[model samples]
Target: MAAQGDNRPIGVFDSGIGGLTVARSIATSLPHESIYYVGDTKRCPYGVRSESEVRSFVLQAGRWLAAHDIKIMIIACNTATAAGLKIAQQMLPVPVIGVIAPGARAAINSTRTRKVGVLATPLTVRTGAYTRAIRDLDAGVSVYGCPAPSFVEIVENELATGAHLQERWLQDGDVFDTPENREEVARTLGPILEPGIGIDTVVLGCTHFPLLVNPIRHALGEGVRVVSSAEETTRELTDILVRREQLAEDDVVPEHRFATTSDNIAEFAAAGSFIFGQPLKSIEHISLDELDRY
Candidate 1:
């Protein structure tokens, strides 16, 4: 029989399709491991929800993932991580990994000037998770947090409409490379990229924010290092698996499954394929109404 630990899949979840970024990274980094991904698309934009509400939603989803016999769980959304990780670590049977600490660690390691900036949803900013994580590593470093809620909408199929974007930023087009587009993005993000902030590294605090890295990096200028938790978090996952001797032993193709709390599984699958550059297998629809029983 196969090693017991290696046979179990890794459970990863986000408020919506954004966590696919994390899933994609995990697949790329560990080709032999199976993944069970859950995206709470029906009640997405978890950024606006109260912490208690988000925590409840997260727990419901966690219980659902646990039923699949996953060996490890990754909380891929910053808002969910802020609201639910502690509770998850306390209650879940498997090791719970979150995006904030990895992202903060990557930023602190990449910064040349001890100055770091974080762009996240307003809810994440309110939690101060990134700020606290960074300071926990190095108390002398300066951390700045900016709420970039619009970026989340832009990534999850909401088109950014403005004369400059002309529906391109939300469309499948590159807007970050062109000078005019960059200028427009800079102008649009002016308030967030405030003056006199000499940060050398920026943490993309929300999982969805990675989709807007180009524009965000351009808006912040060339000098700032843009950091996404996907890669760093994947590295953390790899280390954990190795330390636990849970790494899969073969390169055989692993079964990956997708689940969403949304009624529109077709739309969610389309968006997931677009984000991951691969056709998603049959997506299972999960209902929050039914999940409330657990």
Candidate 2:
């Protein structure tokens, strides 16, 4: 007789809906596993917040998810991961996975020049998590950490305005395709694109960065390779599940549930649907005080 598979849902949390990119990748990679995602949108843009604040926020979200009986948890925000991953792992009941290490490993594998550029939130860059992770993996690699403090706001603004609702926006191009947006992205990305940097691989350190990939790619030019930790993180999740025999059974149907700390649940659903590549059937508005009870 074969060992039974665990059917509990995987928990994923981020500062905002940006983490949907990681949740989407997990759903695609592990179709049989269910997912419970929490987005703390009420106090988003964790990149600009203090390290202690980000850590506190990460724990509140993690504890809430853990109380819901999730099998595992993934800290989908790069800033949160940088600030709170170790403590979350120690405090949470389930296994905790962070995006930075996987992203660093992926960047290392993709870089041919051994010079990798990391575009992330201000706090993430300040923490030097990606730089540390990359160098720890391979001391020969040169890591450049660039702060893109405006990128998250750009993504959140688009999501708030229902830009994601337009089929053309989703299928054809995003807000970054506009001349104004293009200029903004280019200017913000100037440091990494400098001739002296000569990086062949660029890591999207924040989950939100993936939504702006088209514009980012345009700015970086054709020679640079863009990498997102979403896929690599999902791969790590799969390996852990397989080792623990916790992979959802083939016969089990997968269900996805979403929650947000924002008052505007509708906006979250709309943006989440766009990022998740499917209409979100279940979405609930959660409160910070409620999460504290967990």
Candidate 3:
């Protein structure tokens, strides 16, 4: 722990359980720290909601993190981050970070052809967060946005993969990241990606897109580097904590605190264990009836 201040836990939140991807990355990148994660699974898809709704939801959930004495607050959903981060930063005292800036920075630094294709949630694409983040680096970088709604849905419902999990949830391929459907999605998305842009890299700006990495790589063809916001976002969080002198001194057998506002927590935990590459240390359910309390 830093000598100057309290080494309270870090808090991570998302519209749904997909933020576990970010949390999982954080576990590896900052093993010494304790983390509290909240999944707003009740309103799982914030992508189509109005900005006001997203902001309010983030405020409610992020405030819960604050109550937990979190030293840092990470908005793990790209859509929520796009709509809520600016306002959340103003309202919160801690160092607030989001996946967009880090992911964008990574793409800008990695792209050889200056043409970057971004795969994110519908709302993130609608808001042009990735485009703005990339353009902030250099206006000439041809940044394209592709909305992968099904990817988020698959994750929200926890239908990722595995024999037991597959039996638990109905197995039907979606609009993206499916073996049968990926090529078609690519064909449709590829046209929007102008060849003149010389796109040689694609940014998986949405955390859920990380699960789609292999399929996306196959669809985008060879040589296109697929960068997930997961690793880059984790690196950013680590740097921010270190810069702020908030990193824990030693690994505390790193505990994962999972809280969800949905009835499907069992499914999420199963999915998260796979993503975290470890079993959950704890799981708490936020009963829908307790909405007003939270």
Candidate 4:
């Protein structure tokens, strides 16, 4: 809750640049508030890590945000949210929100056939996090899970627009992040997505998956609806903030700050601009070594 003299910005962090998707949604949805976003680029993919490691990584980011005096914290990464939302919320004094619940709720609400599909990282699938969340929300709903480690590669390589996504994502045998492998990756994942006889709604369970939503939608066709956590998470945050009186009242032009654990300014700027749909500013680099000490 925004206490006395508490106009501090909301702090958001993810395992990597993909959480920019969530930051962008909040920036547009709640334009008056300031947001501080951090991407753990050095540990780009947290989905495959152990639960303890994920908890530690998430708390490190959370504690940093708390020290910065943020009134609210957003675990923008789905994997992080799946791994650490409950503990982080209990540990933190302020309101902490994540993407999974909202997205799961939205998926349950949107599926007319009660059959839902989830495309996520190997960690998300292995954790069975999304499946459990959706089932807990509505036992009537069925969730199908797909692990997508390749999606990260496509984003990392900045090759989503071309055929390269196919080779890197589906085939599962390549060390290269190039256009030449896209077809293989696409074909590898295509069989599951090709006109599924069961699922009517598909969930993009990873932050990186949203970057591939267009092609994914194409592959699944109009019958299988797609759900992403971005907009839903923003909406959920807004509701919670309003209830808690943490939402800003005025329509002030908002300022956004972006940071990363790695010193890759160009990659940060590129992905951030695409998500924010504007020229991103205030990009900073802070390593885990320094962050861990605090």
Candidate 5:
């Protein structure tokens, strides 16, 4: 165990369960570290919100997490990261990491061709964070970022089983797994992947986008590589912890805590189980009104 950060839980937050992708990666990569996750499912889809509003929500969540004595803060939402990361670094006492830089690095490393395509939320696309990050790594890389506003809604709706684990997997098919869903996704992506783009790599720039990876891969074809921020972000988090001597040394299985700013916490718990691939036995409910106090 590192002398300084051996016992504190790491904090992670997203607008909703989509960030579970990152959470799953962290659990797999750094099994010894504990995690406290906050999902603001009630006021979610922060992608459509104004930058100032997104920043405020992120800070509210960060404050709540920090109050619990977390060792570090991970903003797992791409929209929130785009809107609030720099401010979060200044505001929070612990290290604050976001999804864009790691995803950008993954894309930059995976692309054999210099062209990379980004599919993300409207706000994230507007921020151009991924483009800037990729360019920062290698100035000559071509980035084509497209706003896929409906993807988040699709994922949320698909994850909505209304508290029943058995019902979560739709009979027709999971959100993007059906032929109809795949066609719709392909139609949505057509303009983004138009002829002559020649992008050899595509970054799933929004955390929610990973849920639709199958359809996205089908739409973009097998030739292009699809990169999600989860894996690389976990890698970055692990590297930071190790470099700072913050890695937990004990063999004890880490305890995970889940919280949500949602009225229907049962649904959120179901969604967590559905998206996170973990049996979420319980979840604490938090209200936006409470977050407003921070």
Candidate 6:
């Protein structure tokens, strides 16, 4: 007799709506599985927070999700992963995965010139996680870390609003293509885009970065390949589930649940809907106090 499939939902958490990128990819890759996503929007942009603070927040989120009976937990924020992955793996009851290693692996595979650039949060770059992961995979390859501190703000505050929510921005009049945004992106990415860099591939080290891919690609030019861990991370999740016989059965009808720490559910829903590529019918607001109880 074959083993029965596990129907428990996957838990994914990020500093803000950025994790929806990873969650969306997982939903597409594993249609039968449900997902429980937690976005700590109130304390978002974890990129700037101290490592200790980020780790504490990550654990709180992980514990809260684990308490809800999730089979696996994914730290979808690059900063959270860099700061808390090891400790989360030690403390969480279920399997815990983060975006960093998978993203580093994807960057390594995408680079033809063996010179890769990483665009991530200040904390993520400061941690040297990507450089360590990439070099561990291939010591011959060179990894350059570039901190784009304002990129997260651009995604969460700018792109998630106004015309961007309508999907029109994705068409010819991309929001990232605006003069102001173009100048900002160019300025922020100048270090990596420098001629001497000679990087053939760049990794979107933060989940939020993928949403700004159009502008990032434009700045990097046609010669550079951009990589995100959304697909690679989902692949790792699939393999883990298969090995543990926890893959959801084909007959399972998946349900996705969204929760946010933000006080305004409407705004979170709107931004989330845009990021998740679907209408978010319901979203629960979770407070830091409530999360602390877990």
Give TM-scores for every candidate, taking all chains together and pairing residue i with residue i. Answer: 0.89, 0.96, 0.88, 0.86, 0.94, 0.96
- Give lDDT tens digits, candidate 5, residues 1-294: 445446688899999999999998998888888889999999889999999999999899999999988989999999999999999999988899999999999998999989998999999999989989999999999999878888898888877755654463555455457787687778878876888889999999889888788888989997999999999999899888878888876676788899998887778877787777777765798888899998
Ordering by lDDT: 2, 6, 5, 1, 3, 4
Alpha-carbon local distance difference test for all models: 0.82, 0.90, 0.77, 0.77, 0.87, 0.89
lDDT (Cα) of model 5: 0.87
Candidate 5 Cα errors over 4 Å, as ranges: 1-5, 162-175
lDDT of 4 by residue, 1-294 (tens): 452223568899888878888888888888788898888988877877888888888888888888878889999888898888888998977789888888898899889989888888777777788888899999878777777776776666663233343344456533342344445446645646655447888888887777666567656766778889989999988877776777764755567788888676765676567656676678888887877875
List the candidate 6 regions with Cα displacement exceeding 4 Å: 1-4, 159-164, 167-172
Off by over 4 Å in 2: 1-4, 168-172
lDDT, residue 2, candidate 1? 28
The alpha-carbon lDDT assigned to residue 200 of candidate 3 equals 81
lDDT string, candidate 1, 1-294, tens digits: 324347689999899988989999999889899889999888989998899998998888888788778999999999999999999888877889999999988998999989888888889999998989999999999988877766676666532222334345457576434565456557655764676767888888888877677777778888888999999999999988888889876766788999988787767776687666577886898887877976
Pairs with steric clashes in candidate 4: 164-182, 166-182, 166-185, 166-186, 167-181, 167-182, 167-185, 170-185
The residue ranges of model 3 lying beyond 4 angstroms of the native Cα positions read 1-6, 157-163, 166-178, 288-294
Ranking of models by TM-score = 2, 6, 5, 1, 3, 4
Q: What is the TM-score (0 to 1) of candidate 2?
A: 0.96
* Candidate with better TM-score, 3 vs 6: 6
State the displacement of the C-alpha of residue 248, model 2, in Å, after optimal TM-score superposition: 1.0
